[model samples]
Target: MLLYHTIALAAGYLLDLLIGDPRWLYHPVCLIGNLITLLEKGIRKIFPKTEKGELFGGFLEVILVCLISLGVPCAVLSTLYRYMPLAGLVLETFWCYQLLATKSLKDESMKVYDRLKNGTIEEARYAVSMIVGRDTSELTEEGVTKAAVETVAENSSDGVIAPMLYMALGGAPLMFLYKGINTMDSMLGYKNDRYLYFGRCAAKLDDLANYIPARISGWLMVAAAFLTGMDGKNAVKIYKRDRRNHASPNSAQTEAAVAGALRVQLAGNAYYFGKLYEKPTIGDKLREVEPEDIRRANRLLYGASVLSVLLCLGGRLLVQFLV
Candidate 1:
């Protein structure tokens, strides 16, 4: 089983690097989002609108989503392994591949870079709006560039390394479960009136789940900066200084690393849902952020992802030897 898991992990990583997420296919995360919406509506109708009711409702929604995420894949994979082992391996590889977002993250962030490079501020803003939660409507060129770089940096943990760690631990089931929680957080875990009470459980769960992975991701980026010929020393320095700068415990971990690696500052005040947020700066502004920094951040992201895969493989082997 360990050997099979290692092979599946490698194959999935390679597949994501080579093909990314195809637009023609229906994604599993999309299905998870739909389930969250369905369950949230039904649960809200049963529970009162008070804080306690919303909190409990959010908890129930997470439980149901996690169960479906784990159960369906477990049943199908187990049945296939019993009847046809090779077929099961193929399906498992595909499932694991779908769980990762390495190339997709690079591709989406590059669109913003390309637009900005071509001197299309409006188009660049549109491209960036697709990925980030913050408003892009009135951003200057540098603001657009900063937003793109920050998204790539932050998602380096959320979209890539975290899923890789979960998949390594429990294969596809745990990976999808993590994704389900992440999706719930993305959809409903806002501080706005609509979700502040209702999405509290999801926000807390997501934070807890990402707590360790986010730190691992930070150190990994520092190492990757060295490997990719960036400022590793500053990456470490800024990471130590600014990792806790964010409102969320986990977000600034990677953002600080990437900002230092590229020798640029990130995370200042920004507009979100039409409200201005006074965010603290992450790193020193030794240099202004450029559109090219998006590409550099993607390079760091890929480097960190490779390091994570190697660590996961080594850790699995060590556990197997001890057991």
Candidate 2:
């Protein structure tokens, strides 16, 4: 079983690299998002619009979402494996491919780069807005580039390494469970008026889920910098120096490493939902971020992802051998 899962993980990573999330297929995350929305609406109807009610509703939401996410896949995979083990492996590999976003992340960031390289500032902003949470309507070229680069750096952990870690540890069901928590966070985990109380559980859960994976991603990225001939020493230095720069404990880990690797500053003030947010800068201003940095960041992300796969598979295999 352990060997089967290890092979499934590698196969899934290769599948994601070859073909990213296709529009035609039904993605599990989309289903999970819909379930969250429906449950949120139903919970709101059942509970009063008060702090205590919201808290209870939020907890219920987490419980229901996690159960469905973990349970459905486990049931299906178990039945399938009982009937046909090979078919089960194939289905599980497909699920793993669906959960990862490595190729999609790279492609989207490059789209922003393409727009900026062609001098289409509006198009660049539009492309970047698809990936980042910040408002990009009034950003400069450098701002757009920085946003794309920063997103690539940060999501290298969230979208790729984190999921891979979960999948390696517990296979497909657990990976989907992590995705469920992440999707909930993305949808409702905000400090804004609407979600301040309603989304608190989801937000805290996401932070807790990502805590270790984020730090591991930071170090993996630093090692990737070293392997890729970037400034690995500076990557480690900046990562330690600025790892705590973000309000979210995990967001700045890879951002700091990538910034130091490239010797460019990232994460100053940025507007979100039409309001300017004052954020501390990460990395030194040794060089200004340019359009090319987007591609460079993608390279770093890909390198880190590859390294993560090796380590996860290697570690799992070693443990299996020892056992």
Task: Tally clashes: model 2.
Answer: 0
The sequence of per-residue lDDT tens digits that candidate 2 reaches over residues 13-106 is 9999999988799888889999999999999999889999898999899999999999999899888888999999999999999899999999
lDDT of each: 0.92, 0.94
Top-scoring candidate (lDDT): 2
- For model 2 the local lDDT of residue 202 reads 96
* Candidate 1's TM-score: 0.98
> Quick one: RMSD of model 2?
0.9
TM-score for model 2?
Answer: 0.98
What lDDT tens digits, residue by residue, belong to model 1 across residues 134-221? Answer: 9999999999999999998899998999999998898777888899889999998998778988888899999999999999999999
